[model samples]
Target: MNNSHLELLKKLADEFQPRTDVNTRATVEAESTDAFATLVDLARDMQNRLDQQQNRIRQLEQMVETDELTGLYNRRGFLRRVRETMARAARHPENGILVIADLDGFKLINDHHGHAAGDAILRHFGQNLRTHTRADDFVARFGGDEFAILLVGSIPEVAERRISDLEKATSRFPLIWQGAALPIRASFGFTVYNGKSDITQLLQQADDAMYANKHAKRPHSESSHNAA
Candidate 1:
């Protein structure tokens, strides 16, 4: 609600309230039937306004947490959820995995294929990630070419297979931009999290593992480039 409407509500509330100095029973008796009905209507109107304000706040929060390009949660939203997950894990005997994936050769693609292709790649990969995961799982785009996935109630072996499936699914459908096919590949690393884990440490571990996986692919990638 606008400030003017808020002030008017306050005024209505103040006008309807029984004064402390007045005799309560006499004040109630002095108010006419029409006055009591008007007071009830005003109270209902104020409640509706308050409900609208709450809804608006929720919508704004959603916008803030969302990534504009990929329609996924942004980093801030991801971290907030991670913290909540951590808190829940502390309270229960649960386990989960956090995966950080970076698009390999993203800078090269952006430089050679232009920003539009880069954006398409990001959007496509993000959608694939969301499609492959369950509704309860968390998926986020942590800006640029980096994304994260949190799989709840998962073991390391299951998490590994899930990541492998995601990698294959994302690359299977190459993005077509400007009548040219642009293949996408991302390196993924994951860390298991439970009640005792720290969020910052978990993220660093996942990032390091992802980089190691990327490095491991370098030899094959270089060989293909040479053959081409």
Candidate 2:
């Protein structure tokens, strides 16, 4: 309890003692009951305020952990979740996969269109991944055109198939803005997590694989500005 609550309680206790000088009277008993009721009211009010404060704190935490544009977990929030997952994995045996994805020709879309269009594309892409993934999976936007997925308890074959399906599904859905259909194509690369490697190493491995995948697609690509 705060000092104010303690002080108010003490004051009430001191002021509302059963009146010994005017005891054996109905008025004195009523006065004592009123004083108890006041204490109860004050305690209830304090508890309500504490609950409101806690709820506000949770809201602030969520805002800080979320990306403003995509409404997905930002890098900080993703990292925190990854750390917690990794720690749990250390204690228990588990298998997971971390995939890093980057939108192909994202800059060209922004250049040909506008930032508004870019924002829409990001939101669409994020929503696509969110709706497709399982409840236990984690999806995050790591700023700009970079996004990630953490597939918990996934086998290598299943994870690969899932990523392939997601890539095809995302490409089929185009964001229509101002009567223009902006196609979304993304390159994804993933690495397995088996409760061993450090976070830095895992991230670097996934990043390298993502770049490699992007490069592999460039040879077969027609135009980088096709999205616009």
Candidate 3:
């Protein structure tokens, strides 16, 4: 993770260096069967330590990137990957879509059902959504009840289909709690990324559009209510 850690690894690996003595007798003694066996055990121990440390490092990195509730990338992890995508897009021909989807009536879910139920639903949705996307796609919990998806190297039609598929996937089953089934709905906005702005700005644009789309839907309900 850092220069010091890397140096430690190198040091661990270099611990089994051959004994370099000018005396032929000393060299023969060092290379004896017993000495060889001891060196082998030391080498094995070093390898075991390296493996353990590497595994710990990987776990720490995952914790840094992952959202505790959903096991999806948090905003930090998402933006880190976004910067990579942006850099790639800058150098080559790129076709990508950024979709920001915010849960509708998420506050009601928390208020009515309690935070535990809300958390259960979020975890279920995250797992369900994982089944619907590709391996290379970037899926993240942006914050709160908002999720973001980056469809890399995809056309508008592909993006559109993916969105439709995702919506359908979520709607397929209501979130079941105890004996009750609760519906979950989300408002989504998607746009093609042209590398016109930085990663953060691009995300903001998608988010703005998502809210706009959400607001746009409110009028119909208002009109229906007003008519009644």
- The number of the candidate with the highest lDDT is 1
How many clashes in each structure? 0, 0, 0
lDDT tens digits, residue span 76-165, model 2: 989888888888888898989998999998988898899999999999999999988998888999878999889988878998999999
Off by over 4 Å in 2: 1-32, 220-228
Residue by residue across 1-228, what tens digits does model 3's lDDT show?
Answer: 999999999998778655454476676876796788999999999999999999999899889999999999998898888888888888886869998988777777888899999998888888767778889989899888889888888878988888888888888868998788988777788878865556667777888888887777676545432211
- Per-candidate TM equals 0.81, 0.82, 0.77
Off by over 4 Å in 3: 1-30, 33-37, 194-197, 220-228
* Model 2 lDDT at residue 26: 71
Candidate 2 accuracy as TM-score: 0.82
Candidate 3: Cα lDDT at 47: 100
lDDT per residue for candidate 1 within 1-228, as digits (tens), equals 899999999999999887874686667767876698999999999999999999999999999999999999999999999999889999997999999999988877888999989999999999999999999899999978999999988999999999999999988989999999999999999999998899999999999999889878887547533211
